[model samples]
Target: MTSDAGPILVTGTAGFIGFHTAVKLLDRGLEVIGVDNVNDYYDPNLKEARLARLGERQGHQFHRIDIADGAALNAVFTQSRPRRVIHLAAQAGVRYSLVNPHAYVQANLVGFANILECCRHHGVEHLVYASTSSVYGANTNMPFSVRQNADHPLTLYAASKRANELMAHSYSHLFGLPTTGLRFFTVYGPWGRPDMMMYIFTKAILDGREIELFNHGEMLRDFTYVDDIVEGVVRSCDVVATPDPQWRSDVPTPGTSKAPYRLYNIGNNKAEPLMRVVELLEQRLGRKAKTIMKPMQMGDVPATCADVDDLTRQTGFQPATPLEVGVARFVDWYRSYHQVA
Candidate 1:
């Protein structure tokens, strides 16, 4: 982004990653105008808690708006006239998409359209949006790389995010909008979404309830820490994407195009077995969790490990936190937040 660009506009500020990224930016004393509807996709109280944290920070301005409503979103752009946008707001969840497909359509698809147009017409310097590792669906390749084909998505959620990349590419091609899309692996830490594995497993273990161990302990994930993810995000925002001069349509790489568009994976670069995550939690909380063995559900992958070579190569950054340490920090926060002994 240009040095003279206006205050950063970040959507989904009430959400997990959004909240963390916003706080980090604010801590740096950067002007940020956050947008979120605060819809109850999960527990509204959790969303409220995240927002409360952001509220405590200076240079953090907020708007209660939904990106799905084009008029409201457009109004925000007209008012804030932000030059750099971190478009993180979207219907996020793999299994939930199967149940409520329309939410994905409205938030992920339609909402992204509004953001693209805003960036195009508003003379936005750069647009960085969230993509997902789930886009690497059905590809059995260990340590998924950005250079690989991701045409087959097991869930609508992943499909929508992949579409966001395509849509952003078109805008970059047409309007010269520098766009960077980061495909994040299983992100976790304090202030994580309750629906994700980290929070669910931790909560169940504490409650003495049976945690659903999907794929019968065979699943693998590159569970990234939230702080590390935020570091990558902040760096990506500062460095606007530029067109790859070497990119050739004759044998094009999907990760980059002739336009100012780029894709990189932000992950731990380490895939841990699902059982290992449980084991670490058991050690942290000092409690045994009864496991309900279950087959892999639809829209789910057997394993995911991100090859962050390009992420490091292009951005000069990496996720350095170890899973055991991150999980321990989370357990500490969880116990404090919920007042668990």
Candidate 2:
């Protein structure tokens, strides 16, 4: 939606999802202020490449600043005077959390607090931030639902995101700031992160290397396409969260409250086996992956399926991108981006 109000501020513009989100906003003829440090998280080159693409678009302003630096982040808010915000910046990676817990604390915790304060003081109409399905840690439910309690986060990354949902709720209650937290499942597509399973498997297979299938390739994941995730995010930004009239104190729901705060699971709503993805990639790439079975690693869930009924009801949208279609698109992009023969 094109807004006549002030520009929309989006954090993590250099990131995979953030880059795609910024493009969506810009294409809609909206002024987009992009904030990103372009850190050496995975590959600064790739981040810069994404930034270069955004720079070509009209109505896009880029700022190189870290969100953890509250002063710098506040400066952006004061200067841009954004009408709304979409926060996607965070220290992502479950295994990386084990090695560097401080990173998660600084980026996810301190950085998020700065964002909340900015929105509170700057009169942001709605704050839509990214959460992860990893918050459903230790819950064996077939399909993860926002109504269910997400109290046991296994990794620091997951715990930090769960904390963001709680932090957003507090702001909504105290300052009347509307907030929406979307717990995303495994998002994959073009311009995907190299650390994710899809990217790693694709690269290794193309290079004639063995692709490790953790948990013996038996894992089921609701692998959402990036375009679908961005659609849900943009729609949530358009629909400001309102207090649930039916909310009760005696029997409170986890996803909604009396305040203008809500949470929704944005996913494909179907769990596909890990091997299914591999097969799709093989078919697209014209090469079979040398598969290696491996045990489950620490801080990883065995399966994830999203219950997107609430998202559908609220946004009139459901992530319906089939795994086969999405994988084929990713492979095509990978080949083009890498300039492979």
Candidate 3:
């Protein structure tokens, strides 16, 4: 079925990646049912603004509901009967997890359980959920691949995300619910989270404030742009996960399964050094950022790169955004939207 004909349910519509994905789906003539709790994670106003933009579109329907509420989630599922579900809502952030661990359990665990239940009951064609590269926790693999082992998660946040992958796999095996888990790497762009690196770095630089250079600017990140991530997401939604005939229990691939479940990484194939990103920002904004070099914090990895070849081969999805071009566009958007100099 094409996007234009049926409705697709997208969770966390107010969030960065969710907002971009919903916008792209709606633009493709899809009827989008968007949901978000509008929690004060960063700024609820930004979330509200994102909702406003979605509301302006003709085929979009929004509900300010918490996914953790099972009854509420079921009610919406019964009413909408969405053909596909994109589960993006979660208690997001690595640093914040250190302070508010309960938030991660409630939103990421409980909310995700609710979404899986709804999808299972509704007989959704595909259930595409967000997993994080943070799940690669403590793995120093040069380019993180779905085929690699990811058992040693560092933070509670990573653990929770890893839990999501397992949860999806369970549902896929038991209920035959097609599930695809996306391990996203350092997504950033316009209308991005104010707490994210790009927004924080750009804001601090513009305001003549010092930007914290974690790991002494020696970190490397895939830094996938929001648009590229959204494209990969939409294409994945179109291709339902299938059980691998070659998947033997004796030797299993971490990416695929004998059940109707799969995992893929959406990231820039090219990794950019942390310092290089700062340099780009400096050049784009014509402002010199006061830098503060610091050792790596706990629950933080020094680098993350994604091997997205599986995604390309399976769904014909490839992230094509160049770092310089994407960064420049983000800078332009930040200035225009925030009225920054």
Candidate 4:
């Protein structure tokens, strides 16, 4: 599905995945209209840095607006007239959701509704949005698959994302909008979010601060690299979703429907122990982390693995970055970005 009609609208372009996804799109000679609030969710400086990089690209145009503001977002849609919308803007973080539940409501739920309306009205070719592995909350099933039951979300963050999947299905059914929801798992690499496990461990290890190992470091994560994630996002964006003829109302699956809606998991597909990640960081940084064991916090999962079979079958791509290589890249970026000798 080619969209030569207008630029691709990518929300949250200043974010880790969005930044990389925009670069990939621009590299493919596509005109991209990037949108982001650049909120102080973490460090605005880092967000600015990512935006600056995107701004350097010739085919890229940026708008500093929050997706929660329906009017502002709609204006961008009016002016840009994007054929495809990559909606990645949302209040991200499971633990933070516990503290600021309203942020999740405003950004994930309300903001998503606004996005859906814009896409529906603007005649978007395909709307690819970020979902999360967190939606597989409280499910002890190994290698989480999109076809499984994901109704039991453990936090507002997870619930909000799960809601996005359902909300997208409605648009696909009602408005004939093609929507694809990507469930990303433990994404980390250069320009990664500071709130994520990779950044936290690297910073604590470098500063010689005690890093708390939740679940006594027994947690397992898919730990996908940022580049691998970008590949999935871009590939998925190019493929417009179609209604599944195999979909049955009686024996329905969450991944596909009779509507033009689909869900896929983007992850390394191999779960690695959390401590193994720490060991890799220690090896790369040449410093042993000052670690303290802690019980798993509420709304936190002990393990996450992705079944990327659907994503692979659809896009002919699967996340293959090894944890060691990915950790090394992140550590290198952290050292340079923080100006740590």
Candidate 5:
């Protein structure tokens, strides 16, 4: 039953994007080997529910393994022998990194090293991993482009993800590994994390609680829907990156490389104001939100937008989910999931 794609390994299968990507892969008649530690970063119940959904699929076999545990991770690679890898596991949360710096080191750094080694030893065809928009750091430019520098990372979380990109590039350069890194914008949808603004604001409005507005509702985010993100992930796996003969050190670009490494931003391409998102949620839920405006917290940028021209040109796809439609769907799922009125 092995197709040309082969069995793909997806880390963090219990997480939002990982689970959605795994399901999409399974639907395409490909085998998936899923791994997740299932820690209590947010709510374990939601993670469990996501896992359960994946369990319903036939071509999936899940392992409760942390990527930071190199021995356990290597065992999975030896056993599954996945032909391609979509590495999504990491300690997530930008603000939380302020208090928990070590978590990023263990998960993002150590886990990433383990993944690269596994892919290297296992002879994987293509490796795709998740990068974040936060890597843009202090760049105030509209529609953050991969061609721009991302050396300034405000938080440990962003720094760790940036390091992952560097590490992948090194592996690609040294070992001839075909790798693609996706810088995902603010991804939100049904089964979203409780810590994300979309879920937090929706819950606060439904409960008549005050939701914190950072930067006094002036901040902007290109909130890419989960399904759109999943599409990007799958397409990236299909389009294996190749060495760019046009790459030259005389005039360099961050998007392509001399080696088989590529980076693309996966985002909505629309920078919607934070306040607009809140208003849309209010309209969808038929409830008013009690607001508490506050200045921007540490390790956070003012806005982020993705320049997806390269992504469309390469994969013939770009995230096009409308904000209102996506928000309405999220509200519906939130109401049904939480049994809200």
Candidate 6:
């Protein structure tokens, strides 16, 4: 069932979520044009390997270009003329932004700007970009909702994503470019980022080393699996956003607008405790983790829970993978990939 939409363009196709999304689209028999600089943010080899897997699939194309390079990005969009655009490339990592602020400015800000510009000029029908749960910063809200106010962000990384949402809204309003932004919650699974908690903890535990338990292992997260995130992303991409007819300026909804723009939180509604996640990982690995409990670090949220009602209503998308199953699968992949018993 090949799509008449021609080739789909996926930016940041080498990254974790982007890679999964690109794979899903390719599996659906759509030609995927993947663009990634393959930067060594964590490990370039991992990025290269992910790209290799995508390359193995028929109808998958790869391009090495930084999205911040306006000229390069424009040329790609012009040549590809993709019907849909999934812009996921960015300088990710909250704590890392503390050390390298410019990276966020270049990748998140400039790169995103370049993407929006290209999408606008190229008449992209649907623009699906990745936002983050961190945008709900400093709020005491449980089960974070996309319709809530997210003006206050806790980190440079979160702020950058917030800016992206605003930037997308403007494009949708002015250019009639239907756009959807997904605020992803603590996504993890097989082939996940090495910098993420699950991967770090699993590796440390397998090596008989102590794993740092931030916030004394009392934190909670909506640990959405990569597969579920990919599913939500692909579904959202297929559904074009439309302006909310009921939107009122006096009582504006943060997640919807009079423009053809919408935002949804693609996350597991269940917030699993950090200690429970570790326990599940240990159970899966058949090894005890030496936990080094410590206070929560800066740019860290103690808890995150997503309310995906809007997502469900819009796309009927619900995260299906349980923490235990996801954790077990991650451990299986980690053991085989790292050659650990």
* Per-model TM-score versus the true fold: 0.98, 0.99, 0.98, 0.98, 0.98, 0.98
Q: In the order shown, what is each candidate's alpha-carbon RMSD?
A: 1.2, 0.7, 0.9, 1.0, 1.2, 1.0
Q: Which segments of candidate 2 are over 4 A away from where they belong?
A: none
Q: Candidate 1, clashing residue pairs?
A: none
Model 2: per-residue Cα lDDT over 149-234, one tens digit each: 99999999999999999999999999999999999999999999999889999999999999988899889999999999999999
Task: Compute the lDDT for candidate 6.
Answer: 0.92
Question: Which of the predicted structures, 1 or 5, would earn the higher lDDT when compared with the native?
Answer: 5
lDDT of 1: 0.92
Instruction: Give residue 232's error in model 1 in angstroms.
Output: 0.8
lDDT of 6 by residue, 1-341 (tens): 25777788999999999999988998888999999999989988888889989989998888899998999999988888888999999999999999999999999999999999998998888999999999999987888998789998999999999999999999999899999999999999988999999999998888899999888888999999999999999989988999999999999998999999999999999899999988998899888999888998988989999999999999989889999889999999988877887
Model 3, global lDDT = 0.92
Error (Å) of candidate 4 at residue 38 is 0.9
Q: Which predicted model would earn the best lDDT?
A: 2
- In order, the Cα lDDT scores of the candidates are 0.92, 0.94, 0.92, 0.92, 0.92, 0.92
- Stretches of model 3 off by over 4 angstroms after superposition: 1-5
lDDT (tens digit, per residue) of candidate 4 on 250-336: 999889999999999999999999889988988899988898999999999999999999999989987778889999999999989
Error of 5 at 337 (Å): 1.1
Better of 2 and 5 by lDDT: 2
Q: Which RMSD does model 3 reach against the true structure?
A: 0.9
Scanning candidate 4 in windows of ten residues, the lowest lDDT window is 1-10
* lDDT tens digits by residue: candidate 5, 215-308: 8988988989999999988888889999989999899888899999999999999999999898899898988889999999988888888999
| TM-score, structure 4 vs. true | 0.98
* Candidate 5 regions with alpha-carbon error over 4 angstroms: none
